[model samples]
Target: MSKVGIIGAGLSGLTLALALHQQSIPSIIYESRPDAPLNIGGAVMLSPNALRVLDRLGVYERIRTRGYTFTKVDYRNAVTDTVTEMQEFGGKDKYGYDALRIYRSELIDVLLEMLEAAGVSIKYGRKFAKVLEETERQVTWEFTDGSRETAQLLVGADGIHSTVRKYLYPDLVPKFTGLAGITAAVPTAQLQAPVDLHLPLTYVLPGKGGFVIAPQQVDGSEQLIGKQRRVEKDLTREEWAAFMADKESQVKFLQDIDPAFPEVVHRAVSNIPHDKINVWPFYVVPRLNAWSSEDQHRRVVILGDAAHAIPPSAGQGINQAFEDVYMLSLLLSDTAKENNKDYLAASLKWWQESRQARVDQVLELNKQIDLRRLPQSQDSDGLEKLNFEVGWLYDIDLDQVVGNWLKEFQ
Candidate 1:
């Protein structure tokens, strides 16, 4: 009961473990996979907010140069090819770190390496079945293998289909957002793009949607060319998995481009290797009344996608997960000495409310981006195009935020 038990060894869970270790809090990671976190996410774009967390946890330096780095995402007119709007992903001059597009595996490797050096243990192939019980001081859980374990705290960083989340919301399911990102990586040269062409560009055709061509890799040798699809009828989790596994169908989806789409898009999807494609269905977890149980014990908790899975509109899906891990660690460390249930409960309340505000902001940002990308978004109703001044998202001070909350409540 001296450490935390973390479910899911994915980015969020591993990062949480390291964040706890940095506070001298020992923990174990239980991953359902037989090996390292399933590296299926392809490459992820990390903005400054998430990078700051990694840098603080000693993960940035290891990966800063391993992937492509850029600062802006250009939304271009499909016909004129002129830029219509831009989203500031990150800026070394403004945010102290440029956005990074690194493979998920590379980042996970660094986290696992750090934890191993720190002597943290990871129980691979140990699937989390469900939370068995929660006491005032500790929580216990069972693995699919019938094994059980207890810890001072139990965290479900176990992603959108989280088994751990079932303990908190027995009937809750991740609602499909009617969209899915269909993507594939091809050599940057395949596009034969004009030299002046922006690296991360989205071309919008009013009625259809955006076609994205974004560079990846440290040398910018490859790019991810993708578009979103609307699924009228939501599929079960198993159905979605099967649909994603159908490489031929996924490739066909990407290739089903409008003739009016830019030539670059056509070329980009011309010869996608079946092995390099990814199908990411958008799913969102409804806002929960509590990230922790209503029971006074509140020993079991959830974070990352398990708590709130937002779409990748502002490319904050991973970035926001990083925030959750970092902020929770700060809050826990702030109240470690007292270990007062009242203080812990208050801190968690503050954490959820504050994080919810940020998530809400991201959702709004996604709406603005959606307006530009999707046809259905034409019914904007009242969504405002917030000035691109997103310093509030990328420029986060985790310690200061948690500290101020503590002082106010004290």
Candidate 2:
């Protein structure tokens, strides 16, 4: 069997490596960052679908013990200071798993631990420079350090600014969504809001701005993951500095939305160190014509944000990445089992055919959710629409899909 070269040891890359390992496939991961276990960004919501994949990878139990699980989502009107809608999170009953909120760093740590236990090789600081060459059977990747590695197949999970994606399709680029977000995590007890701290809440001021507060546990400390988004786009460094420096203005902005909103904002801004607060613009990869190279050998394929980057507003970015990992790993496993000359190409074709439509649907659904969440929308139909979409997303069983695909090959 040929060794697989995976770029970027992110959620998708690590998951793919683990999935391949389950089938006894050998693979190596190349991470650009120098840190062995990189810790960046805020919390991520793992829907039942994501949790199911994690469970299969044998790490869900560990994550669940470290993360926060919630069964309800409260949608509150930031202007009116009232709960506009409430929905029950359908986890075990609907999808046979629980929804979880875990910090991005915590999730990375868990994945790293599992990878180490499995004896997977991950070379850090190996920044991928470009593809040096590709033959009929293998592709060679060059690193910024002038080092090079060759593999039968290359998978790019390098994220939005993926160098592999650029190497394959030079014309494609991620587009900014004309929105800016500020995210921080603070102790839940520090929040002065009068809402149930146990449940997740989304406060919408409509068009002006909005935020979400979800309970999470990071490094054994009970914390509240807070995220605020507004229509500001292409924010400069000085603008971000000004925004962060004016803490009172931020509190007042939230206070004007609703009295309770200020409390959450205050807790996030005051309690969290200034450097920990992240303020940046959001970008999404435009729908791509192809997610894999045109090489007849199928030498290169991109997954996760490298293939389909979506805005964070939908909360489906990481979830969809997990889906990508599950499907690709299964397809690759099937290819390895068959040992057919064209199996790799056939498997890559099947993987894309199975995943592209689903990715398109999620992308459109995310856009709709973003619009519905805005304050200016007069329609109250977002709740029903969101519930339907959530069910559709979280209820999928990738194991069954993979089984059906295998039966076709058999």
* Best candidate according to lDDT: 1
lDDT of 2 by residue, 1-410 (tens): 46899999988888889988987779999999887654556677788888888888887988887777776677777667678776445467766876788878888888888888999999998999898888778899899999999998899999887999987788876777766566555666677655444357777666654676667773324454455455546555587578766655544443343444545655654555444455546777887766777654578889898988887765788888999998777777764465676666666777787777878787666655555456453333353454434676777888898788778876
Query: What's the C-alpha lDDT at position 221 in model 1?
Result: 94
RMSD vs true structure, all candidates = 1.6, 3.7
Task: Give stretches of model 2 more than 4 Å off.
Answer: 87-90, 193-198, 218-272, 335-338, 377-389
Residue-level lDDT of model 1, residues 76-138, one tens digit each, is: 888777898888999999999999999998888888899999899998999999888788888
Candidate 1 collision pairs: none
Candidate 2 worst ten-residue window by lDDT: 377-386
Candidate 2, overall lDDT?
A: 0.73
